[model samples]
Target chain A: MIIAEQKPIQEIKAMIASYQKILVVGCGTCVTVCMAGGEKEVGIIATSLRMALRLDGKKPEITEDCIQRQCEWEFVDALKDRISKVDAILSSACGVGVQALAERFPDKPVYPALNTTFMGMPEKHGLWIETCRGCGSCELGRFGGICPIARCSKGLLNGPCGGSQDGKCEVSKEMDCGWQLIYGRLKTLNQLDQVEEILPPKDWSTDRDKGQRRILREDVYYEQTV
Target chain B: MAEFEPKLIAFCCINCPSSSVTVCESMGMSIPTNVEVVRVPCTGRVDILHLLKAIESGADGVYVAGCSDGNCQFTDGNVKANRRIERVKKLLDEIGVGGQRVEMYRMSAAMGPRFAEVAREMTERVRGLGPSPLRR
Candidate 1:
């Protein structure tokens, strides 16, 4: 899921001072899965804003709304009428949802309440780690399941660069050496022989830096509107 | 004018609102005619902001009424709402408003008279407490 973390309430209050009628929009997809921009978080942000406004001695009208997904137009359409009532919108979605809301509501300002962090899975109940960079290419087959692009301190595509000490990365004594983890995982799977192969220099063009990319399958598309 | 009535915003659950509203009406209280009823699908749906909005919008006091504990049709709605109420109360205290401006209560739909008693009780309590410092 797209990971996100909420900013402090004081910073958020400063952003919406100009608007009297504000909408606190929460995304129920990636942010919700990560427990960042979910319905519950939306309520917390809304309540915080109201209290801050009361402290300022100004009557700010804030409304709260959450949609299943904020990145898609079809889902955002549900909020069209409601969106018209607010002077501004504060999105609890990741970067995608914030941009989507901005595009959908061009007339009104859309501010982000959460900082989009990374693409990762829950490490445990309240902990999450960066796993993938959403790079166009996949190289996990070469290095166990861990993505060197995200886990390796230097995004090293080959074995450790002699910086590993006792299975710990030189970047931090606490961090496990990504290459060591890869070596162990491969050894356990009897795939250590695969590591001997030299990987060519990574082609950055195919990755996200080039621009936005889209994938379409004919099977998923309908000839006529279904 | 029928005298200056204090505006109250009651965030109540389906189960508790019915009884509370009935009780207030029987006692000729009728929520002080200034109270606005915002019923949620469940008290669990009531977030802390709803209470703050009530206070920010000139409400003298905010009350969250929910189904009595295990009596909630939706299981933990009332309990969760109560927890959130307490959390917000702490926040209110931090702001010098003193959490007394907010409260949570549990009741069944059939407990109409009990609702009125709570309304009178809360009304008197709020009356004694005076207007919210934020209220202009």
Candidate 2:
């Protein structure tokens, strides 16, 4: 899931300082699972903002609402009435949800209340670690299912990088060397010979190097015909 | 401000603090009139939102009274509540509200005097801090 964390309350307060009436929107999908921006979090943020604003001697009218998935046009459309009532929006969804709202309501101001960090899963209760870089490619088969692009400090392809010591990365003692994990897993599977096969350089164009990425699915595209 | 009577909210665990409250009342020990006692099944049920809402709604201070450590009926309800109290304290500090206003106290059902003591302590501390800034 797309993991994110709420920005500091002070930062969020500053972003909507000028607006007298603001709508706090939450997403129920990814951010909800991550406990960053869900219905419960929407209420918390809204209440906290009210207290903070009151402390500053500003009586702002704040509203809270959560949609199933803020990234979808249909879900965002449900907030049209609420959006019309507020001067601006404080979105607690990931970056994708914020952008979707911005594009949907170009005339209205929208601000993000979270810092979308990475594509990852929860390591444990209240802990999440990056797992995928979304390089627009999948090469997990070559690395024993461990993602070097996201876990390795340098994202080395043909690695171990002379900095792997005792299975730990040289950059940080807490981080495990990604190549070492691959080596151990391969060794357990009796497939250590695969490590000797040198691979070609990754195609950078598939990544963010080409700017904004999109998929044109002709089968899924719906055309309005009058 | 008229002697600054601090309004406090105490979320007490049903299995222990509830009985303690009764024992204290029956023994002619009176809690401060401004302190409101709310009974919950367990202190673990008290979310940070409830604490913040108490303050937002004009509570000068708020605290949770749960069963002493390992004595909780659910085994670790008091332990979980302790961690939540710490989290709410940090949040209060970040919001510039002063974390000292919120606290957690653990006592057994047999300790009626301890219950009254915690109430007086919290009320006095809040009184010293003055009314909550968010109070209208």
Which candidate ranks first by DockQ, i.e. highest? 2
Pick the TM-score winner: 2
Task: Give the least accurate 10-residue stretch of model 1 chain A, judged by summed lDDT.
Answer: A217-226
Instruction: Rate residue A99 of model 2 by lDDT.
Output: 96
Error of 1 at A39 (Å): 0.6
**CA lDDT, candidate 1, residue B44:** 91
Per-candidate TM-score, chain A: 0.92, 0.95
Off by over 4 Å in 2: A162-166, A223-226
Writing each residue's lDDT as its tens digit, candidate 1 over B1-136 gives 3533456677888666665676657767545555567878888999776777677667888888899868888889888889889977876776556689789988877677777666667777777787777764
TM-score of each: 0.65, 0.95
Estimate, for each residue in A12-112, the C-alpha lDDT of model 1 and write its tens digit: 88899889999999998999999889998898788777777777777799889999999898888899999999999999999999999898889999999
Candidate 1 residue B44 Cα shift, in angstroms, is 14
Candidate 1's C-alpha runs over 4 A off are: A216-226, B1-136
Under CAPRI classification, how is model 2 graded? medium
